[model samples]
Target: MSQGPAPRVLSDEALSELLGGQQFGTLATNKRSGHPHLTTMLYKWDPEARVLRFSTTADRIKVKQLRRDPRAALHVSGGDVWSFAVAEGEAEVSEVTTVPGDSTGQELLAMVRGSVDPADEDAFLQQLVDERRVVIRLKVQRLYGTALDVNG
Candidate 1:
């Protein structure tokens, strides 16, 4: 009998690539009971700043959880079942967008603009306010993951 190949530890570059290559990931926040609250979210990863940004409603439970406990982690798939990465950090939830074109709104604008350029920028900004949205900035402190060498 032969032992199977162990999962290969992903390098810093590989981990960053995996995180930046994908826009959707599982965001985990700590609940009051010390349990992990998981949410599937669309996020923007800034490799240079080591920050992950997410747009969410202010009334959402995740926002409440993050406000109470800033610790959070995001898990992103490496475009395959055998590879993945996790970014752990502290989250700072921005104030709900009350006025369009405000700082929080602007941050949301940048995150949305990364995916699609809204034709009506004003409408987009206003919509964010209407939805009571806020931006969550996760300052990534550590990144670690692994990839399995299946073919090897």
Candidate 2:
């Protein structure tokens, strides 16, 4: 049997556009036992900064895992098609400090809130702040993806 055509590769511009949307992605991290721990995440892709930002609370297991091991992978896919992207990188965790209000943290939160719920942004922002949420900054070492037709 013939193996299908080679997977189509996505351009940098295309990958940037795809990640800029409000779609959720699956973030993969390593657990203490060396098993893969995955969770659905809302991410902010900053092409200029070459980093991906995601939020989680301090009590979350992923946060602890990442604190112990910075390695992570974030995968975003198109629901209607076979297109997908993978970002492999190291993570840095920072608690959102509302007292002093970290500039980078504020900006990241705004980007995430704006994308996820612009209509009710105030409530969402407050909830994030109240929850003691932390931001995960992924410094991307590699990026690869495909935007290919499945039926072709």
How big is the positional error of residue 148 in model 2, measured in Å on the Cα after superposition? 2.4
* Segments of candidate 1 deviating more than 4 angstroms: 114-118
Those runs of model 2 whose alpha carbons end farther than 4 Å from true positions after fitting are: 1-3, 96-105, 113-126, 150-152
> Candidate 1 on 18-79: residue-level lDDT in tens?
99899899999999999999999999999999999999999999999999999999999886
Q: By lDDT, who's the top model here?
A: 1
Name the weakest run of 10 consecutive residues (lDDT summed) in model 1.
Answer: 111-120
TM-score to true structure, per model: 0.95, 0.79
* TM-score, candidate number 2: 0.79
How many angstroms is residue 124 displaced in model 1 relative to the true structure, after the best TM-score fit? 0.4
